[model samples]
Target chain A: EPEVTQTPSHQVTQMGQEVILRCVPISNHLYFYWYRQILGQKVEFLVSFYNNEISEKSEIFDDQFSVERPDGSNFTLKIRSTKLEDSAMYFCASSEQTDTQYFGPGTRLTVL
Target chain B: AQSVAQPEDQVNVAEGNPLTVKCTYSVSGNPYLFWYVQYPNRGLQFLLKYITGDNLVKGSYGFEAEFNKSQTSFHLKKPSALVSDSALYFCAVSTHASGGSYIPTFGRGTSLIVHP
Candidate 1:
């Protein structure tokens, strides 16, 4: 079975520094999404991307966060300036026709 | 708005016993419910989903869920539990919006522990 793949399984960055998390969704998937799970917290939706534009975003996805499908295969989430609270396990998911989403192993971001 | 609730924070069961992780959801329209499992340091793995089908939906790893429309619940169940099944389980719900499918809302995960 094809699975979503993410690069840099663990990321450590200083506060106020920019960080980009990369993911390669399933080959034929259309819709992509980003979610974050804080330690001991529920998974929170960050943003959804379709057709190279943001389809939906949560209040937690503020001005500092941006997503890009720079290429046919790569989807990236860029945080302009990281905060300590931003440290979490970031997951990338993709689906065909918005039915069932397949998730990647996730990138653990540690902001210090 | 769509929301999912996993009432229990943790459920402990002995190996070879049946186990259940309860989940309830609220949605405006028809619901698309799903169950996912997460191992330590791993991503969410698709367990099963209920989308306008028979109430009982079978999924991967000998697991199944029964969707109760009247009760608005989709609870994950496994007949015989294994130690490998110990993981964090999450329930999610989504519904159709104006244009297309709505973003899924996940419940706070329930940790399942199977003691040998």
Candidate 2:
């Protein structure tokens, strides 16, 4: 079965630096989403992207966060001026329609 | 908006015994419920889903969930538990919004520990 794949399984960055987490969703999937989970917290939705535009975002998804589907296959989430609290496991998910999302392995972002 | 609640933080079951993880939801309209499992340091894996029709939905790995409309619950159950099934399980509910997108809301998660 086709699955979502993310790059650089682990990322370490300085608090003031920028970080980009990349993911390649299933080949034919349309809707894409980004979610994060703190070490021992619930998985929180960051943003959802469809038709190359942000469909919806959570309050946690502030100005520092942005998502882009630069190409047909690559979808990326970028965080600028990361804070200490940004340390978490970021997951990428995709679905053909609006239901049943398939998730990627996730990238552990460590903002020191 | 849709919300999911997993009442138990952890559940312990002896191997070969049946196990059930409780999950309830509150939604304005119809709910699309899903069950996912996560192993240590791994991403969430889809176990099963309940959209409409059929009160009982069977899923992956000898697991099944019964959808109780009156109770507003979709609980995950396994007939026979195994040590390999020990992991963190999450229940999510998706509700369609005006924009025609079904955004999912996840519960805190339930930890299942199967003793051999």
Candidate 3:
């Protein structure tokens, strides 16, 4: 079973620094998404990417957030300026056509 | 907007017993429901989904969920609980009217604890 893979399982960054979280979705998936979960909170949708463009985004995905395909295999999320509240577990997910999404192990970001 | 409600914060069950995690949903059109499980420090794992057709949907890890259209509910059930089954479970919903571009709305999640 092919699974979505993410790099830098855990990251620690300064409050004002920029951070990039990378993900490689399933080889044949056409739709990709990013979600985040604050500690003890529900997983929140950040953005969705298709055809190398953002399809939809949530309020949490404000000016500081951007997503890029960059390459055929790599999808990344970048935060221009991190805040303490930005610390959370970020997940990348993919799907073929159905709504059933397969998720990666996630990247834990810690800001101090 | 599509939304999901997981009323219970946590559910405790004994090993070898049946366990259920409740989920209710609200959507404008026909709803597509899903259940996912997350272990500590890991991402969400797809458990099962109900798109159309049969109300009973079977999924990985010996889990199943029944979709009740009348109640707008999809609840996950496992016949026998294992210690490994202890994890955080989430319920999600999306509507077909969104033209497949809609992002799923998730619930607050329910923690399941299986005691031996």
How good is the docking of model 1, as DockQ? 0.66
lDDT of each: 0.93, 0.94, 0.92
Q: Write model 2 residue lDDT over A46-107, tens digit each, in one string.
A: 88888888888889999999999999999999998999999999999998989889999999
Model 3 chain B poorest ten-residue lDDT run = B94-103
**Model 2 misses residue B89 by how many Å?**
0.3
Kindly report which residue stretches of model 1 are placed more than 4 angstroms away from their true locations once superposed: none
Per-residue C-alpha lDDT of model 1 across residues B1-116, encoded as one tens digit per residue: 77889999999999999999999999998899999999998899999988886999999999999999999999999999999999999999987654354578999999999999
lDDT of 3 by residue, A1-112 (tens): 9999998999999999999999999999999999999988989999888887887788999999999999999999999999999999999999887477899999999999
The candidate, 1 or 2, that scores higher on DockQ is 2
Q: Is the docking of candidate 2 incorrect, acceptable, medium or high quality?
A: medium
DockQ (Cα-based) per candidate? 0.66, 0.72, 0.67
Question: Over the stretch B3-95, how does candidate 3's per-residue lDDT look in tens digits?
Answer: 899999999999999999999999988888999999987889999988889999999999999999999899999999999999999999986
Number of clashes in every candidate structure? 0, 0, 0
